[model samples]
Target: MKLNKVTLAVGILLATAGGAAQAQAQPVQNIVLVHGAFVGGAGWRPVYDQLTHDGYNVTLVQEPLTSFSQDVAATRRVIEQQNGPVILVGHSYGGAIISEAGNDSKVTGLVYIAAHALDNGETEASNGKKYPNSAHPFIKSGDGYLTIAPEYYHSDFAADLPAAQADFEAHAQMPTNAAVFTANIPHPAWKSKPSWYMVAKADKIISPDLERMYARRARSHMVEIAGASHSVYQSHPDDVAKLIEQAAQNAQP
Candidate 1:
């Protein structure tokens, strides 16, 4: 399996980087998180707290929603700072970013949270060809950017969230370039790394079927969270943290 091959490659890299430490045992505590478009790294606050409390060194990368390449670059910058093995995690469109950035030698594994884990040359929008996102009607575009209208954010995008909180998120969302989805993926990191995915069964932004398809195709260790919204990172931080911790532990050298 490609996942096994690449994951072993991670261990090999670890063995080569610090021979003495590999003999002593290193758990790969480093974790880098990438946020999706429209939301900033602040959305990861709850998840960060959970992971940090568990004693993992977590770094949340604030992606530039300007472009897919820019987002990938931002993620790579964070990965570059890590001294050892890392588990790269992404949410929503951030999945695409990590798909590229996780190719880095330092990355040992990947975790996708209600995200678009597309294959090589695949785009986020392309992942929806068969199972289009149910929340399309809720999305409003402007000047090459996209965002959820305040009216639809509460109902369609985050129905599981408190109405007031959903409304606030909608209002504070950063605009994401509509063109970002058109960018082609060259070498998806998942093809060469162990992957895990969380399916938000109640997500409207990206169909659950599509999420399943991607996870299955990548041979990801998949978990389904019933009634979780697109904002599962905020709504169900504990489960998200558990999945991430599992990835980190399993990826250990």
Candidate 2:
């Protein structure tokens, strides 16, 4: 009887291991979208709608833009909601949040769209020196928050977008803490997890060269969209969605 009991226990262990393997074979379905500074959650509407339509379990984290820690916490909260593996998608500064938050156990992969994919000790403050762009003159700062100067918002930040929508986007900008750019990442998920990147070749806010450099360093599967501006997520939602789905498909258990 003791031998029989031992045999039963061994069978259960085998079953549990098989179940874990099955879970790993499953493709990622949960997607958490993080929006960048200046643009609110509304900025992700196009990509959000398309991803949901495709039957992915999608969550959009509305980061307070208050500070770096708060943004990471907000993203983690959303990631915690999923029962299975997740693909975290970030836009612009949202990339920084995911680089920190994507370290979660449930996150299977990451997607950065025209974002700052920094490594250890590398902040945008330092990257600015590495890949300087005259883009700063278009930004205005006040009381710890930063936003695009209204006058140059359209031409400088969203050149590919319609002038009217770009104007409204500028008006609806949500200010982010200026210091967030200098915040050091404790652990960048891209270093361990698989990453995919989309570069807006015409991006004026973050230099296109910087995007390429980051993507190359992260070893991200990189795609360059010709003529895409800094607002590529809004201007070219389909391409962004495609790359995100690719990450999900390629993610290992």
Candidate 3:
């Protein structure tokens, strides 16, 4: 009888092992990367490649800087195309997009990289008011859009990058309509989901102190990297990729 009991236990163990193996074989997680205003989805290529190489399904959403609703719609479309829960990542203005998009049932986690994570009843303009240092003077509000004057792209936006690269990015900048900046987010996903944050200590456009405030408000796992600018993802893709991976793991069932 003891022998029979032992044999039954062994069979059960085998079955459990097989089940676990099957679960592992399935796609573990999905990641949707959103770029902030002024940049296209192309900016996310490096990070996308790194995440894909590490076995995560990833998508980069190109936001239409024309309006807040437009950006959210673009992101939601990408989320709908994903197969499973997503670790939604947003940078700069993209963070505002994720704040609303992360509310989707499929979004399992959020990672804000030097990005705004505003709560409900908050607008990007309102959040910026608290910060004293406006590093980028090029930002002008007119014609219903907010734009960075090309001259400030290097010193304010991409200070860490080489002059040529910064110039190229400046040329590619897509101005976001002023309405998007002032529009208040109705629902903030971070309130319900797990969140992580990376503060770029040397960020000129967005004050690092404000980043700390946002991280604190979200109760996020915050990591500070010195000597990094607003384009922290471009300057430190590996670190950004690792943070996303950690968020994904934490979101796993």
Candidate 4:
């Protein structure tokens, strides 16, 4: 009888151990990163690596920059693949994408990095008019698309990056359709979801004041990085990664 009791105790212990292991092995939160205009998913390599290294599933959405609907479709595709809740992050014009895409049922949180989180009835172009200084050169229209002036690449868009990095980014920048910027955001997701914002204090392309304004409007948990430029994800990957992690952790179960 004692032998049988001992065997049963061992079985119970093993079962409990297996249960604990399974609980601990639960999947890490998935993150879908959306890049803004003038760039592709490659721009998120640094953050992507960091998140994957830390055990999060990361998907980089390659926005078409062709139209608002296309960008939203691309973002939705990524979000749909996530196994559990997802944190959708957008940088620059990507903010607009997230604002719309965050409405997806899988997206549990949002992180806006120097992005344009415009509310209802706002377009990217209209938001720019509110600021006094157009520190960044006006985009030229060609073939129904928009391209940034090459000169503004180093001084305005990525002033804080090393010269070589800035040059490479300029060369790699993608041209977006003019119609995308003028497209009004009909429904903004931040209206219903929890959000975080990173304000690049030294950003020249988008005014720091505008960043503050957007963050305030979104009622996001805001963090200000004093010397970072518009490309905060590239310049300070660790900081951005930490914020992404926090957003993931705070996501609903």
Candidate 5:
């Protein structure tokens, strides 16, 4: 009877190990989308719709853009709410938030769309100076907030988008606190987790060369969209969604 008891215990231990391995091998299905500055979560509607239609569980985080820590906290809250391992995707300034928040244990991978992938001791502002884009002249500061000039918004941000749509985006643009750009990243998740990047070749807000550098540093799977704008996620939803789907398909548990 003692030998039988020992055998049963050994079997139980093996079964538990197998279960843990199975969980680790499972493909990631949960997705959390973070939007960049000068815009709100509404901009992710196109990508969200496509992903949902493809049978993926996707959630969008609405950042207040009040401060860097706040944005990271908001993203972490959404990631924690996921039922399983997640693929975190961020656009533009949203990239910086994910680089910080993607350190979550549940995050399986990260996706950056025309976004910043900052390194240690680097802030978005400091990184931008490394490869300046054409939109700087259009940035106007008031009090402590920043926004693009309405007239140049169409040209600088969404040149590939329809004029009317671009105009509407400019009018409804979200104002981000200028101080948010200066916050340094304590830890960038790309250092540990796998990453994927999409570059908008025509992006006037963040230089495409800068995007390439970020991808190279992270060893990310990189794709370039020709003539795409800073609003590539919005203007070319299908392409952005395709790359995200690729990340989801390839992300490890």
Candidate 6:
């Protein structure tokens, strides 16, 4: 009788463990997207559309581009609104925002699309200087804010995009506070969370090498899209959405 009882107890324990693993492996249903500097969340429309069409709950955080803390706050607010575990996705400068805001308990994974993934004490400018790209010559600044010169925007920031669409993005630029580039990350969530990164090989804004370095440092699942420009998320939504979905399916809390 005692042997039968022991066997029953072992069966229950095994079943419980299997259940826990199954729960952890289930696809995360909620996704929060953060846009990089020089643009707003609207640029994520393609990606948002794809994810939503697939039945995932998706929200976009429009950072005011006022300051680092403010951007992080904006992202965290959206994260807090999610009903379940979140896959936080960031593009370009948005990467730094998620690196800080992703520490929220609801955030289970991170996705960076040609974005900066800074470490504590490191500013995006400082990090980028280590692997300089061509966009530097096109940067324009005035009254504490910075933007890419409209004439050079297409070539430097979105070469892979349609000329007309790139022109629209150039004129519709959202100038970011200069201080935003220099702001230090006090606690980068990527250090503790599982991450996925996409490297745009033809990117002229942030060097592909820098993206690779960030992905390597985070031990993230990395995907490289050859001939892609800085606006890979906008130009290639399908691939971006695929990686984000992969994270949703595989990332563990």
| Predicted candidate 4 versus true structure: per-residue lDDT over 1-253, tens digit per residue | 9999999999999999999877755543899999988888887899999999999989999979999899999999888888888899999889999999899888888999998898888877787888543465657675787766777787777777898888888888788987887877777988889899999998876778888898898899999998888888898999999999988877564
lDDT of each: 0.87, 0.90, 0.87, 0.85, 0.91, 0.91
Model 6 weakest lDDT span, ten residues long: 134-143
Best by TM-score: 6
Q: How accurate is candidate 1 locally (lDDT)?
A: 0.87
Model 1: per-residue Cα lDDT over 140-168, one tens digit each: 46577888787888766778888889989
In model 3, the worst 10-residue window by lDDT is 132-141
lDDT of 6 by residue, 1-253 (tens): 9999999999999999999988878899999999998898888899999999998999999889999999999888888888889999999999999998999999999999999999978887887788988775646565788888889889999999999999999999998888988888778889999999999999999999999999999999999999999999999999999999999999876
Off by over 4 Å in 1: 1-25, 138-142
TM-scores for every candidate against the unseen true structure: 0.88, 0.89, 0.90, 0.87, 0.89, 0.93
lDDT computed for candidate 5: 0.91
RMSD of 2: 4.4
When superposed on Cα atoms, how far off is each prediction in RMSD? 8.3, 4.4, 2.5, 4.6, 3.9, 1.8
Residue pairs whose backbone atoms clash in candidate 1: none
The residue pairs that clash in candidate 2, if any, are none
Q: Candidate 5 deviates by what RMSD?
A: 3.9
Residue lDDT tens for model 2, 1-253: 9999999999999999999988777768899999998888787889888888988888899999999999999999999999989999999999999999999999989999999998888998789788886564635465778888877889878899999999998898898888888989878999999999999999988899999999999999999999999999999999999999899888976
